[model samples]
Target: MALNETHDEYEQQDLKRNLSNRHLQLIAIGGAIGTGLFMGSGKTISLAGPSIVFIYMIIGCALFLVMRALGELLLSNLQYKSFIDFATDLIGPWAGYFVGWTYWLCWITVGIADLAAINNYLMFFNDGIAFTPVEGAMISIAAILFIMGLNLVTVKLFGEMEFWFAMIKIIAIVVLIAVGIWMVVTGFTNESGAVASFSNIWSHNGMFPQGWGGFLAGFQIAIFAFVGVELVGTTAAETKDPKINLPKAVNSIPIRIIIFYVLALLIVMSVTPWDQINPKVSPFVNLFSQAGIAAAAIIMNLVVLSSVMSSMNSGVFSTSRMLFGLAKEHQAPQALGKLSKASVPANGLYLSSVALLAGAALQYFVPDTVRAFTLATTLSTILFICVWVMIMISYMRYRKLRPELHEQSTFKLPGGVFTCWLVILFFIGTIYIMSLETDTFEALKVSPIWFIILIIGYFGFYKPRLKAVVDSKI
Candidate 1:
């Protein structure tokens, strides 16, 4: 191995941070806005009642704080390509292995869920169309291939694709929110709710329509809305002008998504009332239908189509990077770090796609109308929270060990170390709340199995890894 500063077995840092401002901007939005919000809003609001507003706000706040911690760390040290890399370098190899793999799993599961959503959406217009699990699996794998192709062509092309995709989602949400507000102002009346107003929220079950019981229940559903928030940090390695733009993208996006989720859901609930909104029907579609637009379903299908694909694209991109980071540290297969001339980790992209092929198989062999998005999403949020927790812990140690780097930071998490501890506690409480949710509880019960494996793997292999790495260096 060349002992030159930049070269190890390969030029570990050969991949340049070439992504521009627009790419980072859209990529940030691409991660946060998904079709789930468009389609799942009605169901979540109905289940949690008018209290769903606070559900979005609360999770949004906690998630923003989590992003704050991430922003501070990424800005202070732009050498770290992604959050997982930061965890590995700061926390140790065990964390690198655990965070990288779990994060990849998180995206793989999300990709499958989005694939299922896409196929189901297609079914809406094709009334007689039938899809077996086999067909669904094929569609999902095909979607993965499409995303891999985009990523492999050029990161910018993938960013451009996401840029337009996020634009569609952004425009759709803005239009929906505006029309919803207009409906409220004009006193729009619907079959489900005679005269819509702020009172529509209270007319049925009130703000806590299901009582405090429902508000608490809303937490379970609300957590999933924060799924892609950390994705903002994933682009750090490729992000051009990361110190300046990365922070701005991370800080501004969470606020924008928060407003979109809370205000939009509140308006939708106000227009339709909690009881009238059907999660299955999609509130976006109902918004158009209630507005008497003949093409509401058409427009919503188009918006959600873009949204789902953008999310899948992001899942492919982020998970590949995590795998790439793992490989760099020798915590995973070195093959994962190999970059193609396009600067994409072609191996991880294709390998993760292979994992997603399992989805196609599952869909073909035994596709259920429900793959249990609620629970799977809940499990993901919990796992994602753990990654965020690790970020704070890693950052905490960084502050303790590298006080000199704090001055280099253009972006720092507001309030310093105390907030890190607070955020960690917030995560712990989130897990407690997960147990409170019956749907999420099943996931919580099973989640420990993953951590147990992590523990076993740590004791079993990680120690030897450090020795092997050192001996190799010698």
Candidate 2:
């Protein structure tokens, strides 16, 4: 069955359900673990010291609540292609329109940011064989084409590629953990006379080494790490046996966080004192290099490279699917609703690629746009939190008006409406935390411009057109 196909479509125009349990599981894992763990963990550890472990757990738990709400909403009605669908049916058409376009832009900006990161990661191999600016741009273009090619082929190819990309990340972390355990148990000492041991976690100035200020500072970076955790919610339409697969994916989030995030960080700190970790360097790379692994830099660079590529791949798939959903609701241009023979949203993919192409051009021509790109990513993070809040809002409406549905739901969100409020408050608090940082604060000031644009577009454009569509049916 296709994602949004109805008997009215004659089975010719719908997203085919080619994704299996395997795809969903790995997609969930890939969404939960991002390149941030590899590239940004050092800064987080340096900021909060050993207490960073608790920070990840706290953020993980909050997002798991958000996922649980999303899972229950998705399973309640299989016709709900994504949260956008339910947001329309339960909240209002306005909610759907806002979330659909906002989510689409979220992925677009994140995709652009990923492209920039890819270019930098490629430059890491700039040894004797230096990559000229032209060569670097070519590499970035090739990467974009490669990911876009996978998306244009089949959804399964995207899933398979993500499975392997995620597998590499998992393997890298597992290897790091295993090696760290060996070093700790054997009391391996480094050149700095620091011995590897579990005691290293708190032995240095204790777990809350930097106190509450530093602990709060960690949230500013750590929240972005979990940006894509709700990504599995987007695949509900194409998932085979979503009831089994979706819950399994959502339920495993806590365990994945403990293993991939909490445990992985614990191992990194155990092997090296938190204070000694370099904020500018990757802890994963540093850990391997410390363990006497000569190819550690090469190996970790490849892993991070693949990690960014995986994100771009997922971004392409997500943005395209979002356009498809929007078109089905008549909120977007009809052309975007068209599907390829492979059941992929070709036009949506093309449009997203064009946006990314613009991003590449910016990188090549402007060259001093890191601040602009950072602002874009920060705004993306703010929009993601908005989407999550909308999901929770939709869930609350579902319980209020569709009480019978809630009664019949087997996989109910624990604490129900109360949990919804708690998650919403947590996100509001996160936005406040963002304001405390100079860089993120700038993004916050700029974010309202996006909503202002959305408001004008909705009233000035989409609403009247939607009204006409409804009037024509009468």
Candidate 3:
């Protein structure tokens, strides 16, 4: 069915059931492999040393629970377009209004930051690449435009690109881990022929090299690395067979977390020694170079570049889809939902690409203007949390409002209402943890202003006195 068809007609098509199993599986891993793992992990390792592994482990558990909860709810009801769609259906239209827009905002800002990071990483090849900022921004802008072109061509092509992009990181990580194990066994440490071995992990202050304080501090970087974990859910609308595919995705997510985060870090710190890690540089690149591996920096740069492109691609794809959904709900301009001959949301994709040019512009005011993007992302996080809570909340309301649906639902939350509250409290606790961090606190301190901007914009543009009507049969 064409997206341009009447709302009644479009809703009748199984938009929720189109995503395939392989697509879902790759997307789950692909989304998780953002530049953070490739570029951001170096900073995290410097802060906590060997203990960063433990920090990742803890985060993985919490995030696992969150994804599991999301899976149970999404599988239970194919009616949900995605979380924002579900939120609107279960909560009020207002919750969907807030979440859909906020998530779009998050992707835009994160896209900018990742693009900036990409430009900086590109400097590895030539220290004198460009300092005028325009040169760097131009490179990312060009990349974004290229990706925008690709995505508008077809959704399946975007999936294919993500699969390849993600594969590069996976291969890099696997090689690193394998090499690390060999280094450990061969006892190859210093150039003097002394073996490094696993002792590096505990050689300092016994794993918690900077004490518990450092371990806790590492969460600042660690949490952000996990930012796009929800990317799989966004693919729900276009997936080929979400029911089987989604569970495959949710189950494999934790395993990838173990390999990419825990094992990879354990290996890096094991051979290099925690104290020797440079915060300003990538530990992965640093390790291979120190070991005299050929073209270490080049390989690492290429891998990180793939990461940047993947993120840009995802940003373009996700933001457009959100706008498409919001348009359906009358929370955004209706034109955004209009599809092209290719069945792709073409306008939304182009608009998001244009939005990222501001990211290129962001290069000018950075270190200062960048704060705006940072706080924007925080509010973005808050907004995502709101949608997640709304998901559980919507489920509760669905149960009460339509008990018959609950009785026949195939994938209900296991513990019923009790688990729902537990997830809610878990969501609240994450916010509390954020409150304790000075930067996150500052970002959140200004979060209300963002909401004000959103609310004002919503009222001015998307507000409608007309009724929201969904056919019962759909």
Candidate 4:
């Protein structure tokens, strides 16, 4: 097929290059900081004590290498839409099909969790309004439709929304960190006589208060915090100036991790002793409330709500694009490949929104937010790890088959194929750790069902369809 003929296809409609560098940078930051940091950090601190800080650093470092490989691959060929395209070229058609579909589900699951979190957060204001379950579900449906409508108009609007939403999260953390610093400097103490000081980090039971075992346990939840960090790569097709913008966003992962993840938690642990922090409540609100911010809970609730919406927005955008990519390759329904007049994947977006409504349905069915959220997030985490592993494998193949590309590449992955091997092993080890825990283990047990369905679909549907296409061409 000629390039022009390919360009004219429904899936090949050129996505507008309207995402500016600022948009890309904030999107990367937004991906790094998830609702996990806001709500789950207290639990992680209780698990690992002060060592939770180190855990975030280590995970951040490993994922940076993963992003580096992704950046190089996307930049190596501007034509490659996302990691899916490269996986297809270097690994095999099966790799592309699995990764593309899995990546789409990764976002779907994340969106589900985000929607649930958002509804729960909205309950903070319900004391006055007395919001019921039906009302909450209606609000969630409305929120999804609102975001979907925004996405249908322009990709630039999506970038703009993420930028402001991420700014809210960044400001909240910075304010909290500043307040923590002041408290530590003045030797402020809460009602329990626990003085705010850096000593709080190590004074209680030492840094390794939970021992190596607890430190390892922290990885189970902290890993989920980084789930959406690869989101920048998905925006490659719509980004302005891929070579410059993508690398800038990718390389900043470490700095973002240090500031947002490590430093924010460091401040939290410093102001409030790790053992004193309640795992059931947000430490972010705890710190501010103790500091006499009377509206801390209300303020933090709004911040977290925005953060969840930001994540869900990214999920909606990426899942549609993944479906768009899958359809282009004939791995999905051809209709999903069709583009809207605005160049948006409208059908894909609509389908993903329908899938997301399951979150609201889950709220009605499950009712227990904690159990439902944990299962959904754990399943999403497992699927995301699968996608990351495929990226690493594809990178290794890229190096072996296209050594010259690696050689000539200005933004080559450090440690080259060696880093790829190490990252893959790290993910495998993360999975083993997950299996030891009851909640995560249950999700792990259920994960294979998705793959089983995929396998049947591949053999029963995809394989025969490919054969028929080939026969027709002949």
The parts of candidate 3 lying over 4 Å away from their true place are: 1-19, 128-130, 190-195, 367-383, 399-417, 435-438, 459-461, 465-474
* Candidate 3: residue pairs that collide: 18-239, 18-240, 19-239, 19-240, 19-241, 20-240, 187-195, 189-196
lDDT of 1 by residue, 1-474 (tens): 422222275455456677888988877777776656765666677778878877777777777877888888777777777777678778877777788888988887777767767776767676627576667777777887888788888777877898899888888888888888888899988865467687787778567878776677667656766678787788777778777787778778656866678777778877887787776667777777776776876788778877888888888888888888877766666778788888888898889888877666656754653444565567777788888888889889888888888766767778789988988897798788778867778878898888898787677776676567776668
State residue 17's C-alpha deviation in candidate 4, in Å. Answer: 1.5
- The model with the greater lDDT, 2 or 4, is 4
Predicted candidate 4 versus true structure: per-residue lDDT over 1-474, tens digit per residue = 532244257544757788999999999999999977886787789889999999999899999999999999988888898877999999988899899999999988888777667766666566534245677578778888987887888898899999999999999999888989999999998877899999899999999999988888888679888988999999988898989889899988999999999999999989999999987567887787677777876798789888988888999999999999887877888778888888889999999999989888877776655666777888998999999999999999999888898888999899998999999999999999889878889999999999998899888887776676566556
Tens digit of per-residue lDDT, candidate 3, span 1-474: 332345554344233244467667777887777666676677678777888887788767666666766776677677676777777777777778888887887788778867667666766776625345667677767888888899888777878888888888789889889988988898776553446677778877788878766777676557667767788888877887778787778878778998998888888888887777776567777778768775866797778778878887887888988988887776776677678777788888988888888778876656332243344445556656666676677778776777887787665556767777887886686677668767668866876776899888767765532232333223
- The candidate scoring highest on TM-score is 4
Report, for every candidate in turn, its global Cα lDDT versus the true structure: 0.76, 0.83, 0.73, 0.86
Work out the TM-score per prediction: 0.93, 0.93, 0.88, 0.95
How well is each residue in 1-474 modelled by candidate 2, as lDDT tens digits? 322333235235887889999989999999988756765677789889999999999999999999999999998998899877999999999999999999988888777667666665665576524355566567667877888889999888888998998899899889888988999999998768899999999999999999987888788667767877888999888889999999999999999999999999999999999998976557887787677776876798788888888888888899999988888777787678888888899999998888777667656664433454455567778999999999999999999989998899988999999999999999999889888878779878988888999899889888887776666656
Q: TM-score for model 2?
A: 0.93
User: Over 4 Å off in model 1, which ranges?
Assistant: 1-7, 128-130, 459-462
Q: Using lDDT, give the best candidate's number.
A: 4
Please give the range of 10 consecutive residues that has the lowest summed lDDT in model 2.
1-10
Ranking by lDDT, best first?
A: 4, 2, 1, 3
**On lDDT, who's better, 1 or 4?**
4
Collision count of model 2: 0
